[model samples]
Target: MINYLYQEQNWKTQLSDLITDPKELLQQLELSTDQLLSGAILASEQFKLRVPRAFVAKMNVGDALDPLLLQVLPHHLELEDHPEFVTDPLGEKEANQLPGVLHKYQSRFLLTLTGACAVHCRYCFRRHFPYQENLPKNNDWDNIRDYIEQNPQINEIILSGGDPLTLTNAKLELWIKRLESVPQVKFLRIHTRVPIVTPSRIDDEFITLLKNCRLQCIVVVHSNHAKELDPYTIDQLKNLTKHQITVLNQAVFLKGVNDCAEILADLSYRLFEANVMPYYLHVLDKVKGAQHFDLDSAQINQIYTELLAKLPGYLVPKLVREIAGEKNKTPLYGETF
Candidate 1:
């Protein structure tokens, strides 16, 4: 459970009051700074540390190997150069057609509303993404709409960013209204981590906006460990399901964080408990700074094979890898019944 004091504060206040300093995070967890702090500080120089206090509260004290902590903690390994790990691993630069628009697939169009996020995962594929150059301005909406209108095959619009929920309800509504204007767009999919990291972001206003929207709304939340799904966060996710909104989860198969089959199975069950479906278990994207989190194919296949045996078919998320320029996410796991 989250602290009662934290629960009382507004989501924006919580967002603004994140733990950015590496020393403070280590101190708060009562872990020694001697062995960890230097590497953490160095790595964080590239991709600054950002994690909510509420999210930090979920991590076990005095344990450096805590799964939730591993997901956010900066490490010295991130600075090492890997040949295959490039800055733009997904080739998003080429796909970036217009400001804030990424036309990756034939049917789905992605819009980056804001580059702000509540929590900064250590293995984020977009750590080096040039968000400032790509963010869509209010004036740029017309161009985005024009592109969507011209692309007749586009039936879905994805709301992604540092995390779209980081934006205010009014701002989200503004873009959503524009998407609603497009007669061809039938689905509005939001890929966000705010609901898991800062559950308070899912307030009544946002819920109402999603519930009343003309387009079929799907909110896909990112969570790697089951421990991140506290009672408070679970209740917030349940609020979406109660209103007939579709909720799904996509987790990265990080090496140290959630590499075990039992942990993956537990996450599936926890998501199910909140009425959220397990969607995609993505293999780590070969981003330059995130190479440390990548697992060998044999390790990935072995864990996933065990995972398949443990969970029901519906609960087992499809193991996939997002190859650059590929038409769809490539499924990595072999056939299972």
Candidate 2:
């Protein structure tokens, strides 16, 4: 642990120097040119490639079928032009009250911290999100704070974004301390992918912020496969849990990645090993450019059922679907939250 801590560099430095060109990323992994063809290159033009070197190192060199590579490497299938796979599949646009504030659930308010992310997964539901209009600027936090005060029923503030942990520790602590002033707010749920892709982000200062926050901190890490949890990532997760911060994972059930029962079971075990609970094994949101990753409910249920047999009830995550305009997430496994 001491060795790992001493070797850690600032994560923001990593973010600025990410591999933006698909060719560069492909070359870095020693992938053949045929694997990342012209159409695949064209597909990522809109979303753009944003993968850190730390994450690229995890991929299997020269293997196009590698799960980690398949996630970030955009394919021609993304341009399927499916009608149902529209932008804003979760209806987040409609719920956007203020620039940063999204009010959909009564008990919680989702605050869009920033549009920046360390890595952009091809299956990201927010691939088409209008960051220009969603991210708040100067004086926006003031309005968002007042809005939170007005809604006394809102007890949880969801720090969602491109990834909330991308912010500086001082900035996170300052803003979160302001959030603690809200008497109604009890929990701070930060949805992030940094720990999985950019484990260096969880440094001593980052852990300090988590420990010092007045509100109960829940770090919902986005990890699709067990392989994402490399030794460094697992060590960082241990550091998070050492501070007694609640760590949970939300996995997207992608078509080629972790679709099988055994894979999901293995993923659950790996998460448990790191003291992170399997929270939601979500069906891919029908977002534009992400139809390639979508799987049917019957298949999802079968996988979940097989997972139930392989592990204890607690290890199984809820097979859930998020329907736009629905009051809550509609569960496919007949379980309600």
Candidate 3:
């Protein structure tokens, strides 16, 4: 497990420690000379895999090789030309009923709190999410609070964005207090990649805030592969479990990422072990630039059947798709008994 109190090494220091020789770093993730020379100089430090100080402690210190760290490190040169990715792929702005409030579903509202993330995932469904135009400033949160106050039918408020946990503890506390004022909003869900990408975000204060909230809190984390859940992440997951937060995970099926039966099974098993329920294994949303990541329903069904054979009913995450304008995610191919 990762030690929360451990000192954090700066990204530069961390990279210096890893790169014994520049060529050695390139060999690990399998980059070509053309790939490295093009813009590798531009983001060389970023190329080295970086996990949070908390995440690093979870790994075997004796063993320098770590998988979770690699995923977050900015090695992919493809990110440079990803400008076509846009800010809002799903057109969430159109769905926003209020400045910071998005009523994409009937009973639930999504609040765009902050536009920052510790690490950017390449396969993010909202890679193009419009944060500049849509994000709520500290004072602007009143707009969201007022909207929810008026819409008593909204029982759930989803805290989203690049990642809501990126908000400071105090700011988050204020937001929760405001939301609690609305008696109708019974549930609060936080969709985040922070705990997975940077486990340091999980701490006593963070857990305490969630535990003390008047509304029932549920955390839906994003973890694509089993490798992403290291010892530090597991400890963080356990903290959420102890708090009685309904901890769940939703993974987007990515092609070069995790699109296999064994990897999917391991991801589910790891989540279960860490006390996070495996909720949904989502088929990639067909956004413009993410076309390479899409997996067809036929292949998804094959993996689903294989997963069923490997794990019990509860352990298997639903094979699902989220269609725009749909009330809920539709299950694509889970067999009925």
Candidate 4:
């Protein structure tokens, strides 16, 4: 288990600066302490890795109170104790028939464009995913296209990976063009944290590409805490809306993060304020190394009920957990006090 005291002191000293430039960040990451502990450290554990210099400069370093760092830095993950935690928590790779394509649930096909993430989230279920084995090939599109073609009822195509937005605009546009060729596809959702972690990812060119797409573009952002959204992030979100993209946020319930009634409620309100609808408050996925962050189902139900009581119906996000083989996200309600 990670001692909060040690985490705070260590994080304070280690993440002295934030950097966002991908190339420079990659260089620093190459030398990151986290790399040395990759297979060794549990996902919940705290270790000092170099934050992107650009991302760090945005933090209120003097305050020693940065939400960005909390998401990325490794804390003391209880690897020895968390025997139940497995390497593949969401059963992601097993759904893959071809590289980059995951046909898990009905009506939805997930394209793993790239395995690079701007921020390494502590609670990410896919942290241990084997990306090298799944790199998309030029002809992989035909395979994915065929899968979607076989399932005419499938209307949604989800672009997810380390973050699909990690792909260059040209590459993403090519993928979008191919998906658009499918007549049955109506919804194109891009699940990403890139814009939140590095708001610059949402430049005008990126917004324009989605705007031009035929399918209804839905950008599902992952932001756990309200503090993660600042004026710059709001501006980036605004750009998405300006292009008529529907912006939604899905937050994972983490232990030290936004686990409280007030914190979660405020997050919903803030996302609304930024023109993004608060969609789902996910119970932490049962991924190994992330067990420490899981809130019990009973506790999650209590929080969900309290949120309903506090916020208006529309602002309250649904509390749910994903169960493999289940057709839908199991809504956690009517169970706890």
Per-residue accuracy of model 2 over 1-337 as CA lDDT, tens digit each? 4325423656787777788888888787777687466756888887887888778877888888889988988788887899988888998888899998888888897888789888889988888888877788767878888898888888999999878888888778777887898888999999999899888888999888879888999999989999988777888898999999999999999999889999998899999988999999898898999988888777777778889899998988877788877877777773432
RMSD list, candidates in order: 1.8, 2.7, 5.4, 7.6
Q: Which residue pairs in model 1 clash with each other?
A: none
Please write out the lDDT profile of model 4 over residues 29-138, one tens digit for every residue: 35344443453244323322434343444444433225555556555563545765777767776788788888788888788889877666767788778887898888
lDDT of each: 0.92, 0.85, 0.69, 0.72
State TM-scores per candidate. 0.98, 0.95, 0.80, 0.83
TM-score ranking, best first: 1, 2, 4, 3
Candidate 3 lDDT score at position 206:
84
lDDT of 1 by residue, 67-117 (tens): 999989999999999999889889999999999999999999789988888
Give per-residue CA lDDT, model 3, range 1-337, as digits (tens): 1353432433323322333233444454354465444443444443223234444444343232244433333444434445444445566667877667779787898887877665555455665666678767678766776777787778999998867887778889988898898888999999987777666577778899999999999999988878778776788789888878999999887765676788888998999889999998888765544555656677777877888899889988888777667778778885431
The lDDT of model 2 is: 0.85
Please identify model 1 stretches exceeding 4 Å from their true place.
335-337
Which candidate's TM-score is highest? 1
Q: What is the lDDT of residue 313 in candidate 4?
A: 93
TM-score of 2: 0.95
By summed lDDT, the worst window of 10 consecutive residues in model 2 runs over 1-10
